[model samples]
Target: MNILLENIKILAENENISISKLEKEIGSSQAVLSRAIAKNTDIQAKWVLKIAEKYPQYSCDWLLKKEGPMLREMTKNTDIYGLLEDGVENFKILTTSQKQIIESLQKVIFYLEKQDETGRQEKNKNN
Candidate 1:
Protein backbone atom coordinates (compact mmCIF):
# COMPACT_ATOMS: atom_id res chain seq x y z
CA MET A 1 0.00 0.00 0.00
CA ASN A 2 1.04 3.58 -0.56
CA ILE A 3 2.40 5.50 2.41
CA LEU A 4 -0.37 8.08 2.18
CA LEU A 5 -2.98 5.34 2.05
CA GLU A 6 -1.42 3.66 5.06
CA ASN A 7 -1.60 6.94 6.92
CA ILE A 8 -5.25 7.34 5.89
CA LYS A 9 -6.01 3.80 7.04
CA ILE A 10 -4.31 4.39 10.35
CA LEU A 11 -6.30 7.53 10.96
CA ALA A 12 -9.54 5.85 9.90
CA GLU A 13 -8.96 2.87 12.17
CA ASN A 14 -7.89 5.04 15.08
CA GLU A 15 -10.96 7.25 14.79
CA ASN A 16 -13.39 4.41 13.95
CA ILE A 17 -14.42 6.24 10.83
CA SER A 18 -15.17 4.72 7.43
CA ILE A 19 -13.22 5.77 4.34
CA SER A 20 -16.35 7.25 2.80
CA LYS A 21 -17.11 9.20 5.94
CA LEU A 22 -13.56 10.42 6.16
CA GLU A 23 -13.55 11.54 2.55
CA LYS A 24 -16.75 13.47 3.11
CA GLU A 25 -15.46 15.01 6.30
CA ILE A 26 -12.34 16.14 4.50
CA GLY A 27 -14.38 17.61 1.65
CA SER A 28 -12.85 15.25 -0.85
CA SER A 29 -14.48 12.85 -3.24
CA GLN A 30 -14.06 9.10 -2.82
CA ALA A 31 -12.32 8.84 -6.20
CA VAL A 32 -9.81 11.53 -5.25
CA LEU A 33 -9.12 9.94 -1.89
CA SER A 34 -8.79 6.50 -3.42
CA ARG A 35 -6.39 7.73 -6.07
CA ALA A 36 -4.33 9.55 -3.50
CA ILE A 37 -4.17 6.44 -1.35
CA ALA A 38 -3.19 4.35 -4.33
CA LYS A 39 -0.37 6.78 -5.11
CA ASN A 40 -1.72 7.31 -8.59
CA THR A 41 -2.21 10.99 -7.86
CA ASP A 42 -0.79 13.57 -5.57
CA ILE A 43 -2.63 14.99 -2.62
CA GLN A 44 -2.92 18.75 -2.38
CA ALA A 45 -2.11 20.78 0.71
CA LYS A 46 -5.78 21.65 1.16
CA TRP A 47 -6.67 18.00 1.57
CA VAL A 48 -3.96 17.52 4.15
CA LEU A 49 -5.10 20.60 6.00
CA LYS A 50 -8.67 19.35 6.02
CA ILE A 51 -7.61 16.04 7.48
CA ALA A 52 -5.41 17.74 10.05
CA GLU A 53 -8.27 19.95 11.04
CA LYS A 54 -10.67 17.05 11.41
CA TYR A 55 -8.19 14.92 13.31
CA PRO A 56 -6.26 17.24 15.50
CA GLN A 57 -4.73 14.40 17.45
CA TYR A 58 -2.49 13.24 14.60
CA SER A 59 1.02 14.60 14.15
CA CYS A 60 1.97 15.42 10.57
CA ASP A 61 5.46 14.10 11.16
CA TRP A 62 4.23 10.82 12.57
CA LEU A 63 1.86 10.39 9.67
CA LEU A 64 4.79 10.55 7.26
CA LYS A 65 7.29 8.45 9.20
CA LYS A 66 7.02 4.72 9.83
CA GLU A 67 9.40 4.92 12.80
CA GLY A 68 7.64 7.72 14.65
CA PRO A 69 5.09 7.28 17.40
CA MET A 70 1.53 6.92 16.15
CA LEU A 71 0.49 9.36 18.85
CA ARG A 72 2.33 12.64 19.19
CA GLU A 73 3.14 12.21 22.87
CA MET A 74 5.86 9.69 23.70
CA THR A 75 6.39 7.98 27.01
CA LYS A 76 9.89 7.83 28.42
CA ASN A 77 12.15 4.99 27.19
CA THR A 78 9.88 4.08 24.32
CA ASP A 79 11.85 2.15 21.71
CA ILE A 80 10.39 3.28 18.42
CA TYR A 81 10.71 0.62 15.73
CA GLY A 82 11.40 0.90 11.97
CA LEU A 83 13.41 4.04 12.46
CA LEU A 84 16.02 4.63 9.76
CA GLU A 85 18.70 6.90 11.11
CA ASP A 86 21.43 5.32 9.01
CA GLY A 87 22.30 4.69 5.40
CA VAL A 88 20.74 2.19 2.98
CA GLU A 89 23.80 -0.08 3.36
CA ASN A 90 22.93 -0.56 7.02
CA PHE A 91 19.44 -1.76 6.13
CA LYS A 92 20.85 -4.08 3.46
CA ILE A 93 22.95 -5.95 6.04
CA LEU A 94 19.93 -7.56 7.75
CA THR A 95 20.05 -11.37 7.75
CA THR A 96 17.54 -13.54 5.90
CA SER A 97 15.96 -14.47 9.22
CA GLN A 98 15.43 -10.82 10.02
CA LYS A 99 13.77 -10.30 6.65
CA GLN A 100 11.51 -13.29 7.27
CA ILE A 101 10.54 -11.96 10.67
CA ILE A 102 9.58 -8.62 9.16
CA GLU A 103 7.53 -10.35 6.48
CA SER A 104 5.74 -12.45 9.09
CA LEU A 105 4.95 -9.36 11.11
CA GLN A 106 3.53 -7.73 7.99
CA LYS A 107 1.25 -10.71 7.40
CA VAL A 108 0.03 -10.57 10.97
CA ILE A 109 -0.65 -6.88 10.59
CA PHE A 110 -2.64 -7.56 7.41
CA TYR A 111 -4.70 -10.17 9.22
CA LEU A 112 -5.51 -7.76 12.02
CA GLU A 113 -6.45 -5.13 9.45
CA LYS A 114 -8.94 -7.50 7.85
CA GLN A 115 -10.48 -8.21 11.23
CA ASP A 116 -10.72 -4.51 11.94
CA GLU A 117 -12.44 -3.94 8.60
CA THR A 118 -14.94 -6.70 9.35
CA GLY A 119 -15.71 -5.26 12.74
CA ARG A 120 -16.15 -1.80 11.30
CA GLN A 121 -18.55 -3.09 8.67
CA GLU A 122 -20.56 -4.98 11.25
CA LYS A 123 -20.75 -1.91 13.44
CA ASN A 124 -21.95 0.14 10.52
CA LYS A 125 -24.59 -2.44 9.74
CA ASN A 126 -25.82 -2.42 13.32
CA ASN A 127 -26.15 1.34 13.19
Candidate 2:
Protein backbone atom coordinates (compact mmCIF):
# COMPACT_ATOMS: atom_id res chain seq x y z
CA MET A 1 0.00 0.00 0.00
CA ASN A 2 1.13 3.53 -0.69
CA ILE A 3 2.37 5.46 2.36
CA LEU A 4 -0.12 8.23 1.75
CA LEU A 5 -2.97 5.79 1.57
CA GLU A 6 -1.73 4.06 4.69
CA ASN A 7 -1.68 7.40 6.49
CA ILE A 8 -5.17 8.24 5.21
CA LYS A 9 -6.41 4.87 6.43
CA ILE A 10 -4.85 5.55 9.80
CA LEU A 11 -6.53 8.94 9.91
CA ALA A 12 -9.93 7.50 9.06
CA GLU A 13 -9.52 4.75 11.63
CA ASN A 14 -8.49 7.22 14.31
CA GLU A 15 -11.51 9.40 13.47
CA ASN A 16 -13.79 6.36 13.79
CA ILE A 17 -15.25 6.96 10.33
CA SER A 18 -15.39 4.70 7.32
CA ILE A 19 -13.68 5.49 4.01
CA SER A 20 -17.10 5.99 2.41
CA LYS A 21 -17.98 8.59 5.00
CA LEU A 22 -14.66 10.29 4.54
CA GLU A 23 -15.26 10.35 0.77
CA LYS A 24 -18.62 11.98 1.35
CA GLU A 25 -17.13 14.57 3.67
CA ILE A 26 -14.34 15.45 1.26
CA GLY A 27 -16.74 15.56 -1.73
CA SER A 28 -15.05 12.69 -3.48
CA SER A 29 -17.02 10.21 -5.51
CA GLN A 30 -17.91 6.90 -3.85
CA ALA A 31 -15.03 4.45 -3.49
CA VAL A 32 -12.56 7.05 -4.65
CA LEU A 33 -10.23 6.69 -1.72
CA SER A 34 -10.95 3.01 -1.42
CA ARG A 35 -10.15 2.32 -5.05
CA ALA A 36 -6.96 4.30 -4.85
CA ILE A 37 -5.83 2.41 -1.80
CA ALA A 38 -6.68 -0.91 -3.38
CA LYS A 39 -5.00 -0.13 -6.70
CA ASN A 40 -2.01 1.53 -5.04
CA THR A 41 -2.64 4.73 -6.95
CA ASP A 42 -2.30 8.32 -5.81
CA ILE A 43 -5.24 10.53 -4.97
CA GLN A 44 -5.70 14.02 -6.32
CA ALA A 45 -4.29 16.97 -4.46
CA LYS A 46 -7.67 18.64 -4.29
CA TRP A 47 -9.04 15.74 -2.27
CA VAL A 48 -6.25 16.19 0.23
CA LEU A 49 -7.02 19.89 0.50
CA LYS A 50 -10.71 19.19 0.92
CA ILE A 51 -9.96 16.70 3.67
CA ALA A 52 -7.77 19.26 5.40
CA GLU A 53 -10.46 21.91 5.06
CA LYS A 54 -13.18 19.63 6.34
CA TYR A 55 -11.14 18.53 9.34
CA PRO A 56 -9.07 21.47 10.47
CA GLN A 57 -8.13 19.86 13.78
CA TYR A 58 -5.89 17.45 11.88
CA SER A 59 -2.51 18.72 10.83
CA CYS A 60 -2.35 19.27 7.06
CA ASP A 61 1.42 18.95 7.04
CA TRP A 62 1.18 15.63 8.75
CA LEU A 63 -1.51 14.50 6.33
CA LEU A 64 0.72 15.11 3.34
CA LYS A 65 4.27 14.65 4.63
CA LYS A 66 3.73 12.75 7.86
CA GLU A 67 6.21 15.19 9.37
CA GLY A 68 4.33 16.43 12.39
CA PRO A 69 1.71 15.54 14.94
CA MET A 70 -1.50 14.09 13.52
CA LEU A 71 -3.48 16.51 15.65
CA ARG A 72 -2.70 20.19 15.76
CA GLU A 73 -1.14 21.30 19.00
CA MET A 74 -3.05 23.63 21.27
CA THR A 75 -1.11 25.87 23.60
CA LYS A 76 -1.48 25.10 27.28
CA ASN A 77 -2.25 28.77 28.02
CA THR A 78 -5.05 29.08 25.49
CA ASP A 79 -8.28 30.29 27.11
CA ILE A 80 -11.87 29.54 26.12
CA TYR A 81 -12.12 32.77 24.19
CA GLY A 82 -9.07 31.84 22.18
CA LEU A 83 -10.50 28.43 21.39
CA LEU A 84 -13.87 29.89 20.37
CA GLU A 85 -12.21 32.47 18.16
CA ASP A 86 -10.00 29.86 16.57
CA GLY A 87 -12.97 27.59 15.97
CA VAL A 88 -14.91 30.36 14.27
CA GLU A 89 -11.95 31.36 12.15
CA ASN A 90 -10.62 27.96 11.16
CA PHE A 91 -13.94 26.23 10.59
CA LYS A 92 -14.98 27.91 7.38
CA ILE A 93 -17.14 24.93 6.42
CA LEU A 94 -19.36 25.30 9.49
CA THR A 95 -22.94 26.28 8.74
CA THR A 96 -24.16 29.70 9.85
CA SER A 97 -26.43 28.18 12.49
CA GLN A 98 -23.55 26.12 13.82
CA LYS A 99 -21.43 29.23 14.25
CA GLN A 100 -24.31 30.98 15.93
CA ILE A 101 -24.70 28.07 18.32
CA ILE A 102 -21.02 28.26 19.16
CA GLU A 103 -21.44 31.94 19.97
CA SER A 104 -24.46 31.19 22.13
CA LEU A 105 -22.53 28.45 23.92
CA GLN A 106 -19.69 30.87 24.57
CA LYS A 107 -22.10 33.29 26.18
CA VAL A 108 -23.50 30.54 28.40
CA ILE A 109 -20.02 29.47 29.42
CA PHE A 110 -19.08 33.03 30.29
CA TYR A 111 -22.20 33.41 32.41
CA LEU A 112 -21.48 30.16 34.20
CA GLU A 113 -17.88 31.12 34.83
CA LYS A 114 -18.96 34.44 36.27
CA GLN A 115 -21.44 32.71 38.52
CA ASP A 116 -18.79 30.29 39.71
CA GLU A 117 -16.34 33.10 40.38
CA THR A 118 -18.93 35.01 42.35
CA GLY A 119 -19.70 31.96 44.43
CA ARG A 120 -16.04 31.40 45.12
CA GLN A 121 -15.59 35.01 46.18
CA GLU A 122 -18.57 34.79 48.52
CA LYS A 123 -17.18 31.65 50.05
CA ASN A 124 -13.79 33.33 50.52
CA LYS A 125 -15.38 36.28 52.23
CA ASN A 126 -17.31 34.02 54.60
CA ASN A 127 -14.14 32.14 55.53
Candidate 3:
Protein backbone atom coordinates (compact mmCIF):
# COMPACT_ATOMS: atom_id res chain seq x y z
CA MET A 1 0.00 0.00 0.00
CA ASN A 2 1.07 3.56 -0.68
CA ILE A 3 2.25 5.70 2.19
CA LEU A 4 -0.78 7.92 1.77
CA LEU A 5 -3.25 5.10 2.25
CA GLU A 6 -1.15 3.61 5.00
CA ASN A 7 -1.08 6.95 6.75
CA ILE A 8 -4.84 7.34 6.44
CA LYS A 9 -5.47 3.86 7.82
CA ILE A 10 -2.99 4.47 10.59
CA LEU A 11 -4.62 7.76 11.49
CA ALA A 12 -8.09 6.21 11.59
CA GLU A 13 -6.87 3.31 13.71
CA ASN A 14 -5.16 5.69 16.08
CA GLU A 15 -8.30 7.82 16.37
CA ASN A 16 -10.49 4.72 16.82
CA ILE A 17 -12.58 5.90 13.89
CA SER A 18 -13.73 4.59 10.54
CA ILE A 19 -12.10 5.72 7.32
CA SER A 20 -15.34 7.24 6.04
CA LYS A 21 -15.80 9.15 9.28
CA LEU A 22 -12.23 10.34 9.19
CA GLU A 23 -12.63 11.36 5.56
CA LYS A 24 -15.64 13.43 6.54
CA GLU A 25 -13.67 15.21 9.24
CA ILE A 26 -10.76 15.75 6.88
CA GLY A 27 -13.10 17.24 4.25
CA SER A 28 -12.14 14.70 1.65
CA SER A 29 -14.40 13.73 -1.20
CA GLN A 30 -16.61 10.73 -0.56
CA ALA A 31 -14.65 7.60 -1.49
CA VAL A 32 -11.67 9.70 -2.52
CA LEU A 33 -9.41 7.98 -0.09
CA SER A 34 -10.71 4.57 -0.97
CA ARG A 35 -10.31 5.28 -4.64
CA ALA A 36 -6.78 6.48 -4.13
CA ILE A 37 -5.99 3.41 -2.13
CA ALA A 38 -7.53 1.17 -4.73
CA LYS A 39 -5.61 2.89 -7.50
CA ASN A 40 -2.48 2.84 -5.38
CA THR A 41 -1.55 6.45 -6.04
CA ASP A 42 -0.34 9.24 -3.82
CA ILE A 43 -3.01 11.10 -1.93
CA GLN A 44 -3.55 14.74 -2.61
CA ALA A 45 -1.47 17.12 -0.49
CA LYS A 46 -4.55 19.13 0.43
CA TRP A 47 -6.24 16.04 1.88
CA VAL A 48 -3.05 15.15 3.73
CA LEU A 49 -2.93 18.61 5.27
CA LYS A 50 -6.57 18.37 6.23
CA ILE A 51 -5.96 15.07 8.02
CA ALA A 52 -2.87 16.50 9.65
CA GLU A 53 -4.85 19.49 10.83
CA LYS A 54 -7.59 17.37 12.37
CA TYR A 55 -5.23 14.74 13.82
CA PRO A 56 -1.82 16.16 14.49
CA GLN A 57 -0.76 12.89 16.09
CA TYR A 58 -0.02 11.77 12.54
CA SER A 59 3.28 13.45 11.87
CA CYS A 60 3.29 15.49 8.66
CA ASP A 61 6.87 14.50 8.01
CA TRP A 62 6.03 10.87 8.40
CA LEU A 63 3.07 11.24 6.11
CA LEU A 64 5.03 13.04 3.45
CA LYS A 65 8.36 11.24 3.62
CA LYS A 66 7.47 7.94 5.30
CA GLU A 67 10.10 8.84 7.92
CA GLY A 68 9.91 8.66 11.68
CA PRO A 69 7.08 7.25 13.76
CA MET A 70 3.52 7.58 12.47
CA LEU A 71 2.52 9.53 15.54
CA ARG A 72 4.40 12.49 16.96
CA GLU A 73 6.12 11.58 20.19
CA MET A 74 5.70 14.49 22.56
CA THR A 75 7.94 15.00 25.51
CA LYS A 76 6.85 16.25 28.93
CA ASN A 77 8.97 19.28 28.15
CA THR A 78 6.96 20.00 25.04
CA ASP A 79 6.18 23.68 25.09
CA ILE A 80 2.55 23.53 24.16
CA TYR A 81 1.83 26.99 25.41
CA GLY A 82 5.25 28.56 25.11
CA LEU A 83 4.00 30.64 22.24
CA LEU A 84 1.93 32.49 24.78
CA GLU A 85 5.01 33.28 26.82
CA ASP A 86 5.14 36.66 25.19
CA GLY A 87 1.49 37.32 25.98
CA VAL A 88 -1.83 35.54 25.92
CA GLU A 89 -3.34 38.02 23.51
CA ASN A 90 -1.27 36.74 20.63
CA PHE A 91 -2.04 33.05 20.92
CA LYS A 92 -3.38 33.27 17.40
CA ILE A 93 0.16 33.87 16.25
CA LEU A 94 1.37 30.46 17.29
CA THR A 95 3.02 28.41 14.56
CA THR A 96 1.12 25.55 12.94
CA SER A 97 3.11 22.96 14.87
CA GLN A 98 2.27 24.55 18.23
CA LYS A 99 -1.41 24.68 17.34
CA GLN A 100 -1.33 21.07 16.21
CA ILE A 101 0.17 19.94 19.50
CA ILE A 102 -2.55 21.70 21.43
CA GLU A 103 -5.22 20.16 19.22
CA SER A 104 -3.66 16.71 19.47
CA LEU A 105 -3.52 16.99 23.25
CA GLN A 106 -7.18 17.87 23.29
CA LYS A 107 -7.95 14.81 21.19
CA VAL A 108 -5.87 12.64 23.53
CA ILE A 109 -7.79 13.96 26.53
CA PHE A 110 -11.09 13.22 24.85
CA TYR A 111 -10.00 9.73 23.86
CA LEU A 112 -8.85 8.93 27.39
CA GLU A 113 -12.10 10.14 28.92
CA LYS A 114 -14.06 8.02 26.47
CA GLN A 115 -12.03 4.94 27.33
CA ASP A 116 -12.53 5.62 31.02
CA GLU A 117 -16.27 5.95 30.52
CA THR A 118 -16.42 2.65 28.66
CA GLY A 119 -14.32 0.94 31.30
CA ARG A 120 -16.61 2.20 34.05
CA GLN A 121 -19.64 0.89 32.19
CA GLU A 122 -17.99 -2.50 31.73
CA LYS A 123 -17.06 -2.68 35.41
CA ASN A 124 -20.59 -1.80 36.46
CA LYS A 125 -21.99 -4.49 34.19
CA ASN A 126 -19.68 -7.05 35.77
CA ASN A 127 -20.90 -6.18 39.26
Candidate 4:
Protein backbone atom coordinates (compact mmCIF):
# COMPACT_ATOMS: atom_id res chain seq x y z
CA MET A 1 0.00 0.00 0.00
CA ASN A 2 1.06 3.58 -0.59
CA ILE A 3 2.31 4.94 2.70
CA LEU A 4 1.38 8.59 2.14
CA LEU A 5 -2.10 7.73 0.94
CA GLU A 6 -2.51 5.28 3.77
CA ASN A 7 -1.44 7.89 6.28
CA ILE A 8 -3.91 10.39 4.83
CA LYS A 9 -6.66 7.79 5.07
CA ILE A 10 -5.68 7.03 8.63
CA LEU A 11 -5.70 10.69 9.58
CA ALA A 12 -9.07 11.24 7.94
CA GLU A 13 -10.49 8.22 9.69
CA ASN A 14 -9.10 9.31 13.03
CA GLU A 15 -10.66 12.74 12.52
CA ASN A 16 -14.00 11.09 11.69
CA ILE A 17 -13.97 12.69 8.28
CA SER A 18 -14.29 11.48 4.74
CA ILE A 19 -11.51 11.74 2.17
CA SER A 20 -13.53 14.38 0.35
CA LYS A 21 -13.91 16.34 3.55
CA LEU A 22 -10.23 16.08 4.31
CA GLU A 23 -9.37 17.30 0.83
CA LYS A 24 -11.73 20.23 1.20
CA GLU A 25 -10.28 21.05 4.61
CA ILE A 26 -6.81 21.16 3.10
CA GLY A 27 -7.99 23.37 0.18
CA SER A 28 -7.34 20.63 -2.35
CA SER A 29 -9.46 20.16 -5.45
CA GLN A 30 -12.17 17.52 -5.18
CA ALA A 31 -10.88 14.03 -5.95
CA VAL A 32 -7.32 15.33 -6.29
CA LEU A 33 -6.08 13.33 -3.33
CA SER A 34 -8.56 10.55 -4.06
CA ARG A 35 -7.17 10.15 -7.57
CA ALA A 36 -3.61 10.15 -6.32
CA ILE A 37 -4.49 7.64 -3.64
CA ALA A 38 -6.38 5.50 -6.09
CA LYS A 39 -3.46 5.52 -8.51
CA ASN A 40 -0.90 5.02 -5.73
CA THR A 41 0.96 8.13 -6.85
CA ASP A 42 2.66 10.87 -4.92
CA ILE A 43 0.80 13.94 -3.72
CA GLN A 44 1.87 17.52 -4.28
CA ALA A 45 4.11 19.10 -1.66
CA LYS A 46 1.68 22.00 -1.32
CA TRP A 47 -1.06 19.62 -0.24
CA VAL A 48 1.25 17.99 2.25
CA LEU A 49 2.13 21.39 3.69
CA LYS A 50 -1.53 22.36 3.73
CA ILE A 51 -2.43 19.19 5.58
CA ALA A 52 0.34 19.81 8.09
CA GLU A 53 -0.85 23.39 8.61
CA LYS A 54 -4.51 22.47 8.81
CA TYR A 55 -3.96 19.58 11.21
CA PRO A 56 -1.06 20.18 13.52
CA GLN A 57 -1.96 17.23 15.69
CA TYR A 58 -0.93 14.81 12.97
CA SER A 59 2.81 14.46 12.64
CA CYS A 60 4.13 15.59 9.22
CA ASP A 61 7.22 13.42 9.71
CA TRP A 62 4.96 10.41 10.11
CA LEU A 63 2.94 11.37 7.07
CA LEU A 64 6.06 11.79 4.96
CA LYS A 65 8.31 9.07 6.34
CA LYS A 66 6.17 6.98 8.69
CA GLU A 67 8.84 7.82 11.26
CA GLY A 68 7.01 8.67 14.45
CA PRO A 69 3.58 8.48 16.05
CA MET A 70 0.74 9.66 13.87
CA LEU A 71 -0.49 12.06 16.49
CA ARG A 72 2.07 14.31 18.09
CA GLU A 73 1.79 14.51 21.85
CA MET A 74 0.81 17.92 23.10
CA THR A 75 2.82 19.30 25.96
CA LYS A 76 1.25 22.03 28.02
CA ASN A 77 4.50 22.82 29.72
CA THR A 78 6.63 23.28 26.62
CA ASP A 79 9.39 25.77 27.29
CA ILE A 80 10.54 28.68 25.14
CA TYR A 81 13.75 26.83 24.38
CA GLY A 82 11.77 23.82 23.21
CA LEU A 83 9.60 26.03 21.01
CA LEU A 84 12.72 27.68 19.51
CA GLU A 85 14.28 24.31 18.86
CA ASP A 86 11.14 23.07 17.18
CA GLY A 87 11.00 26.25 15.10
CA VAL A 88 14.59 25.76 13.98
CA GLU A 89 13.92 22.15 13.03
CA ASN A 90 10.82 23.11 11.09
CA PHE A 91 12.76 25.88 9.34
CA LYS A 92 15.49 23.44 8.39
CA ILE A 93 12.95 21.04 6.96
CA LEU A 94 11.33 23.79 4.89
CA THR A 95 14.59 25.51 3.90
CA THR A 96 15.32 23.44 0.83
CA SER A 97 12.00 24.12 -0.87
CA GLN A 98 11.34 27.48 0.71
CA LYS A 99 14.80 28.77 -0.11
CA GLN A 100 14.14 28.24 -3.79
CA ILE A 101 10.90 30.16 -3.54
CA ILE A 102 12.58 32.89 -1.55
CA GLU A 103 15.35 33.21 -4.11
CA SER A 104 12.85 33.40 -6.95
CA LEU A 105 10.86 36.07 -5.15
CA GLN A 106 14.00 38.00 -4.36
CA LYS A 107 14.98 38.03 -8.02
CA VAL A 108 11.54 39.30 -8.99
CA ILE A 109 11.70 41.99 -6.34
CA PHE A 110 15.14 43.05 -7.45
CA TYR A 111 13.96 43.35 -11.04
CA LEU A 112 10.95 45.37 -10.01
CA GLU A 113 13.03 47.65 -7.82
CA LYS A 114 15.50 48.24 -10.64
CA GLN A 115 12.68 49.04 -13.01
CA ASP A 116 11.26 51.50 -10.51
CA GLU A 117 14.65 53.12 -10.07
CA THR A 118 15.08 53.45 -13.82
CA GLY A 119 11.64 55.01 -14.12
CA ARG A 120 12.51 57.52 -11.40
CA GLN A 121 15.77 58.40 -13.14
CA GLU A 122 13.92 58.92 -16.45
CA LYS A 123 11.36 61.11 -14.69
CA ASN A 124 14.15 63.16 -13.11
CA LYS A 125 15.84 63.56 -16.49
CA ASN A 126 12.54 64.74 -18.05
CA ASN A 127 11.99 67.19 -15.15
lDDT of each: 0.60, 0.68, 0.67, 0.70
Could you tell me the lDDT of residue 68 within candidate 2? 75
Better of 1 and 2 by TM-score: 2
Model 1: CA > 4 A from native: 74-127
Question: For residues 11-125, could you state the per-residue lDDT of candidate 1 as single tens digits?
Answer: 9888898877889989897766776766645465556557755664465555544546666542221212332444454455434334543453454345446656887899999
- Residue-level error in angstroms, candidate 2, position 122: 74
Clashing pairs in 1: none
lDDT tens readout by residue for model 3, 1-127: 8665787777788788888888789888788887777777655555765776676556765665467788787543344466556566445545555776666455544544665688789999999
Which consecutive 10 residues in model 3 have the weakest lDDT in total?
Answer: 75-84
TM-score of 2: 0.58
lDDT of 2 by residue, 14-57 (tens): 99999999999898999999999999876766676567657656
Tell me the lDDT of candidate 2.
0.68
Predicted structure 1: lDDT: 0.60
The digit string of per-residue lDDT tens for model 4 on 1-127 reads 6676898988999999999999999998999899998888766666766786677666666776577787766453233345556777555545543454455345434544665688789999999
Error of 2 at 81 (Å): 10
Candidate 3, lDDT over the whole model: 0.67
User: How big is the positional error of residue 72 in model 4, measured in Å on the Cα after superposition?
Assistant: 0.9
Identify the superior model by lDDT, candidate 1 or candidate 4. Answer: 4
Per-candidate TM-score against the hidden true structure: 0.50, 0.58, 0.58, 0.58
Of 1 and 3, the candidate ranking higher by TM-score: 3
- Candidate ranking (lDDT, best to worst): 4, 2, 3, 1
Ordered by TM-score, highest first, the candidates read: 4, 3, 2, 1
Misplaced by over 4 Å in model 3 are 75-127
